[model samples]
Target: MDLNQMLSEIEGGNDEEIERLLQRYNSENNRTFTFDQKEESLRIKLCQSTLAVLRREVPFSCQRTCLETLRIMSRDKCVLSPVATREGILTLSLSQNGLQEDNLSEEEERVVVEALKCLCNVMFNSPTAQQICVDVQLAPVLCGKLHSADTWHHEVGLFTLRLLFLLSALRPDLRMCLRKDCQAVTLLTKMLEHTLDINWWLTFTAENNERVMEALKALFNLTLNEPEGEEDVRQCRVIVSLLRHVLMLKTETVEKTEELHSHAVNLLNNLPVSCLDGAGRPACASASENLKVKPEIGNTMRNKLVRLMTHVDWGFDIMSGCEEEPRPNPSEDMTEEQKEYEAEKLFKIITELTRHDMIRPMVVRPDGQLGSLEDKLREIANDDDEANNSDSD
Candidate 1:
């Protein structure tokens, strides 16, 4: 029950006991327990001790509980820096000491997953931890997980990426490393393109949605302001693949469709404005003869985006008559503020896409179904000018 007694048991106890002790402090029902400052300090000490054991070769069960305890401890910002430094974040990052996918037991795999999650939790808001992540070259280790054929690995990779995105935003140097040194954009593209099967839509889970959303969001952060970063993504022909994926979402049942849509569209907004050829000239949208996106594919990409922009129910119709209760619209669950922000992101994407000479006319031409976005803009400008003129009088 006391801190020293708890540590003794954890250092010498069996897995069940260890897990029970950890859960006792971490249980959601024990909300009042979190307010005890002394107990919180004890929790940090326990986390440090657990991580110390985690660094060595231990029973797989013990390793898991260690990770689980750390995962819970990491939720407290007060403990994060100490855990990051004392627990050896950098050491755990090395491939030799870290978790791997090859020849893993199911239990071992779960342990690896928990370890990754624990790291994510510690690094979530701690600048020191985030710096250590970059200094230790953690991105490559996480990238390896992204390339694994196992879905669990993919899930872990994305979970880690979400943390890295936050770190990179606060540290430009880390962002550069992730983009240029770690090649995050390229690795994320591969993960995003990992298709399950022809019947993949049916098998998709919340895990899949989270993975793809994080991947897109990470790429968006990496490429947001760096021209070279954006160029690297453009060279990967991200627009073509991203557009196709968005189109496929119509038939899919994802838990966070709005997040996926928002991220995908934001990434599209981040892509290089002009996809050019090697000759230093504007590449024809219809010709993929020399570019990463093929000619025919380009048109299909545009059409798909247009369809999404125009029709909200294009893909949901097929799910209308299902035997089970209809899946709730994720949009309805969103806060009013969040919904407004998401709508702004969509509007920005539509605005940016129409800037291309090829797309502008089609999207805003008179007689279009959505009416002219250009006309709307001009009308707003006129209203503003008239207001200014009247104010002068």
Candidate 2:
């Protein structure tokens, strides 16, 4: 079977022809696969038509085959090449059409979303596909579609985000590709905003929520190391709102899901001072007391989020003190403004590191941040003493 011909059929949603081609290709490729389950599994990926075919077959009884086919495709690099990308683009285009066909049930829609997710593994993570994303103008198109109220379009939109999520986990450097697009930040933050619609994309139970989480994670990784500017303030606001939304969830399982909590911490880690109110409201407000993040609470957030990471992955631990410390003013330590300032600074650093690179500080040997931070603290501690002496004078 010809590869281009198979791709055309996939574009048209013809599954049988693609399957026939797959079985024949597998027969030829089968001999090459060694029987150890892991290696044997890699053999299943040998056929070029496998991912495209399984994506179409997702609704059929053989769903497991497609799932495994995609899983295998993700593990290897060859599946991400140009030819595979054409197949993925065609797959998503086909997914767009399927959304309009009312004859399909929600179950089948889910199958397609899952299939699109498979296609995204290549689009977001595959280095080969990076050029394709720019050539095809994929990021903005997908972000726009994500906002569609139509269910089918919405699902396809979410499917697009799933690709972004994989890109972050599998290829940390590709995040710059997204930042180049002027709309990328707003596109990502919109998904994070607290929605009046419980069924909206970010809500945990919503069908599209997984895609939202994927984008959130990817955006978190993308901005982790990025420097602060005017927009960093808004980014922090968007994150705090997301945290409030997650904490508001009534379900113990969902709220406490190790995943969601980690997300909360990730946002907190990158919280910037510009975005934080001295008082710690969603935005700075004159009405409230300052937001205080106790040192222990910060430590707890780090511990809970680390479960998602591996031992080799670095920079999870964060300890901070006020900058320009050792102040002569006793009033500084107890104020709400001071407390919120410290929390914002700590979160911002974590956020920067999380967004830019997976590597965190090893910290076995000090970066020597502690001693400098301690002296600053000592100066701040003298604020009251200095003030009393001045008053006496």
Candidate 3:
């Protein structure tokens, strides 16, 4: 196959021809060439052709095929170099144009989805491409996509947001830009709350679980080291929402629940540490004042967490209506794996909660009607020590 000539044909071809070319490239069974320099050069040419077609005022169908081709081409790192080049990034203008249209055909919408995915692929580990995206004012376009009523739009929006978040971690300019955009903060926070919804518990799949975790991670990244960002997060009540998410995780299997629990704790830890301001200042004498939590709300959340910490077991057992006496050996029936996982999550959550002044007392109080959370920690520590001793003997 004359790949360069084929790419040229695809770029200028009619809609039917473009679709045929895209399908040919998309089909794995049709691939027979070795992954040598020739093949790499072919992929790079295809990326160029895809961008050229996208940049032109073509039929929407041709544009859609162009995006599909770009997506396929983006999978190879050699192709990605061309895709992120100055000429290649101009295709983002086309993507922005299509996404701005209020009325798009199903095919055009599909193209939009693929375009976002292609953008994600092109920018992966490519800081130059990420900068190009920011230079082109892509964040606002992505933030706009998040507001669409369509679920496909939301899904791709999240995928793109995940990429942007990764980029922001290494690019302080992008991070500040996102932090200054109130819309970005609002959208990310709303996504977090929606993913943390109880409805997800009933309709959960591994895919949705992963998406939720990604959303949390993105939100965490957005809030990192920015006092204004943290304030925006506080207004969203993410602290309370994440706590609810932790409670909901009890419904998952032990391994899955522990994974989600770790993410939840990370998000909690990402919240602005009350003792330290953005400039690393701890001038505030009252830690409670730094938290910005209303007294009643703080007490309520503290009480909920206190209950979580002292519970004999996780999940439904914590909510069981039967008032059975506390087990003398709660760890007896649990496998060593389950015991370690359970203890780690509990300790992490308590440690994060104690960072706030209003919650610290409940966490560290030495006495309680049914033993303090501190008592539970001591018991877990003793069990770990005894287990280690048994192993040695």
**Model 3, which residues run further than 4 Å from truth?**
1-5, 8-13, 29-34, 59-61, 100-105, 148-154, 198-210, 226-233, 250-259, 272-393
lDDT values, one for every candidate = 0.62, 0.52, 0.62
Query: What's the number of clashes in each of the models?
Result: 1, 26, 0
lDDT tens per residue, model 2, 166-281: 64455555556565553555666666553324543343564445544566676776676644566656666766666655544422254445555566557556565555454233
Question: Model 3 over residues 1-393: C-alpha lDDT tens digits?
Answer: 567778778767876787677777667523432345667877777776667666667766776667766766666666578777666676754674456435656776666767767777778746678788777777776666556523544445456666656665556566666767736666766665665563555734555566666666666676676456456646446454554555455434656655665666566666645522342223433653432322223334343343334334432244432244456888889999999999999988887888763464435444323445677788889999999999999
Name the better of 1 and 3 by TM-score.
1
Top model by TM-score, which number? 1
All models, RMSD in angstroms = 16.0, 17.7, 16.7
Per-candidate TM vs. native?
0.61, 0.50, 0.59
Better of 1 and 2 by TM-score: 1
